[model samples]
Target: MTDAIRVTGLTKRFGARTVVDAVDLRVPEGRIMGFLGPNGSGKTTTIRMLCGLLTVDGGEGTVLGLDIRTAAAAIKRQAGYMTQRFSLYEDMTVGENLDFAARVQSVPGRRARVAEALDRMGLGGRRDQLAGHLSGGWKQRLALAATILHKPRLLLLDEPTAGVDPQARREFWDRIHGFAAEGMTVLVSTHYMDEAERCHAIAYIAYGKLLAAGSVAEVTAAAGLAAADVSGGDPELVRRIKALPSVETATAMGAQVHVAGADAAALAADLDRLAAEGLSWRPAPANLEDVFIHLMARRPDPAEAAR
Candidate 1:
């Protein structure tokens, strides 16, 4: 089967500034593809280009089997996009907004579609409430309802869980899984590591570059970071270990110092020596956040992208 989304050498620029640089990506059908990057890393720009909301400056890709350059309108029609900000009318009631969306999408049985959306999002009882008066979580629910009202094949979510409470984020992810189980493909961009872990595949972009792409385990393994958990804050211990030639990252976390380096044996030996200095140590799995931060620090500053 054809991938849900496929692109190669995708690049977007504004004037002399390149926002998305020569990125390649593929998302298999019936899977959640997580897009991860720091702010201004061109994640949103790339997603927009894929969904055909914005034309690409230089690149070629197919979304939902449609040529991105020539069939953008068709791709847009087949995709449901939930942007980072709330774009619905605040003056309208919850049900009214959904009704407006269904009508705009020209969905058959518009009234029934609106009702279903309200129920699906658990906003049925608050249907008559003004959207402006709702909390961040409720507004998110409404936005989701509106976006999926047309039953699009592909869902593009840009930081959909931002500013939402933990419980609300959980509920939102549950809904996404439900959609994916039903054979719908989803591409979500998020800053949260938990959210990224929920995806079947993750792509990490930095400075408009595609840094890593794979299952969680695959990416972490590829990072080649050796980590040691050290308890008790010792300025001398940190300084001593950091001074070692092989140690790449030695930083404190709460009462513990997570020391990581490319050489497992070297990091281990350093920790063992620290134990002689009254420090407690244990082997720990290298965290994804650590790997990515290390990756970012190694990249050229994004400010240079505009040059």
Candidate 2:
């Protein structure tokens, strides 16, 4: 599969601070690539560079078969970007917002395009309602409709479902999948592990660096982490287990306690002792959350490093 986005040593600097250090990324055509990282980890910066919304201070890449450095204007015209926050005018009605977007994008048949977008997003009934009056979910839909008003081949979504409800998030993802099915490339930044798993592949960045990039199963397997879920363990037992030298993470999942570690042999020895205290455990597979947390721990924050 051809890479819809391919960059090598992609770098972005803000003044003296290198917000996006030398990083490389590749997203296959027509696939959703999840951008995962903690806040201020340069995910937004990397994405902006990919779509040519921001200038590349240093690096080389191609987006949509055009050079990123010189073809930014053309890239912007073809790519759709939805910011993390709702950016449409609140005073405008849904229909007005979409219509205005159509005009801004210079879309042909503005009226027809706006009507189609309204129906596509299921906002036909609320087209006349003020954008501010819509719920979070509806607001999300309006943003997406406006983003794709001109039918962009590349979609860059920055935490698009941050505060939306579960059902709404699911519905939004369904639409995303639909677009991908039709050969639209998507790169989305999200904090939700479930959302990351839905993507065809994921890239994890931290402290201006790209640490992990692969399919969910591949990334999870690369971490070399082991875990065990324990039942019949009290909250105090969880606390005691977490204090063990070999334990990396000990989290409670309702009635069960999940623990993971890098030193599997040591961890097993520790757990075996705890099992005598009425705790029952079976080796559990390492999951995305476990891998995500491990990656986060692997990188030290730049601020912390300076201090």
Candidate 3:
């Protein structure tokens, strides 16, 4: 498949601080690529640059085949952007808000387009409801409806499911998949691991750098980390496991401790010794969260590194 977005040496700076540093990214047409990163890690900055919402300090790329540097207006016209907040006017009714959006985008057949957005987003019955009166889920649905009112080919969603309940988030993702099935390309930034796993692939960013990118299995495997699940009643065991030279991270989840390390042989040896202490040791597949934490730990703080 062809790439909807292809960029290299994408860099952004604020004053003396480089917020996004020499990042390279590609999103294939008709695919969903999750943008994962911790707070202040430049995920938002990168998304803005991709959609042409923000100017790039250094980079060369195309979004939807339009030059990112020179064709920002054209790029913005074809791309749908949903900000982290509910950007629609709250006092306006659902239908009114969509109508306003349609008008703002200068959508042809504005009335019909607004109606279609309402029906498509399942907000038809609630069209008369005030935007402020809607719940978090409904607000999200409304935001999405407004976003697609202009029929953008590419969607840039920034933390689209933040603060939403699980069921609502699931429904939102279902709609997103429906859009992708219809050939819409999506690049969504999110912090939820479950949401990250739902994407066709994920790009992990840290300290303004692109650390990892690939399918879930590929990224995890590329981390070169081995993990083991230990179940025991002894809390002291968890502490000891964390201090081991072989273990990179030890996380306690209920009665089991999930330990991981980059060196498989060394981690296995450490587990073997711990197993002698009557703890149950079982090999566990490395998860996305584990790989992310490991990557974050390995990278230095961008500020400190700059100094």
Candidate 4:
């Protein structure tokens, strides 16, 4: 498959600090690549560089077949970026906001395009509503409408559903899937594990380094964590399990506890203790959240290491 975005040794530093290390990434055309990482792990910086909003301190690659180093402006023209925060003129009406975006992007047939975008995003009925007066869900719709006002080839969504209600979030994802079906390459950053699972592929980063990539199954398999679901709701039991030297994580989920660790033999011994205490737990498969937690715990903070 042809790649819509491919880059190698992508690095960015702020003064003496390296925010993004020598990272290599490939996003295939017409695919949804979920960018998963903790805050301050260079996800935003990397996205900015890809779309030409920020200069690349180091890297060489292409976005939509244009040279990233020299064709930044050209790249920006065809790429739509939606920031984490709602960024639109609150004082302006929904229709007015979209019209301004079309004008700024120099979109052709501005009137028709803006009208089409408004309808597509289900904002046609609310076109005259002041942006600031809209609820969180409506605001999200408006932002998305503006992002696609110019019909960009690549969509970069950075935590787009952070504060959206569950129903609105689902509808937004439906639209995203529709765009991907029409062959638009999408690279979205999200903290929600369920959203990440919806993506065609995943790229996980921590401490400025990529720790995992590939499908959900592949990443969880590579993590190689031994996990179990122990049945118990007692807080004291959970606390004791957490204090176990070999147990990496013991989280209470409703009436049960999900536990995991890297060392099989040692962790099994801890489980045996819980079994003797009349708690029942069976071996379970490791999941995406478990893998990410394991990854973060294993990676030391660079700032802490420097000191």
**What is the full ranking by lDDT, best candidate first?**
3, 2, 4, 1
Residue-wise C-alpha lDDT for candidate 2, range 1-307, written one tens digit per residue: 8988999999999999999998998988899999999999999999888887789999898988889999988888888999888999999999999998999889999999999999999999999999999999999999999999999989999999999999999999999999999999999999999999999999999888999999999999999999999888566878898899888888989989888988899989999998888788899998888887888777778789899
**Candidate 2: which stretches are off by over 4 Å?**
none
User: Clash totals for all models, in order?
Assistant: 0, 0, 0, 0
Model 2 backbone overlap count: 0
Cα deviation at 47, candidate 4, in Å, is 0.4
Q: TM-score of every model?
A: 0.94, 0.97, 0.97, 0.97
Which stretches of candidate 4 lie above 4 Å from their native place?
none
Candidate that beats the other on lDDT, 1 or 3, i.e. the better one: 3
Q: Give the Cα lDDT of each candidate.
A: 0.89, 0.92, 0.92, 0.90
Candidate 3 lDDT over 127-165, as tens digits, reads 999999999989999999999999999999999999999
Model 1 spans with C-alpha error above 4 angstroms: 234-245, 302-307
Which segments of model 3 are wrong by more than 4 Å? 304-307
Using lDDT, give the best candidate's number.
3
Could you give candidate 1's per-residue lDDT for residues 94-146 as a string of tens digits?
Answer: 98899888888889999888888888999999999999999999999999999
Q: Residue 225 error for model 4, in Å? A: 1.3
Q: Which residue pairs overlap in candidate 2's backbone?
A: none
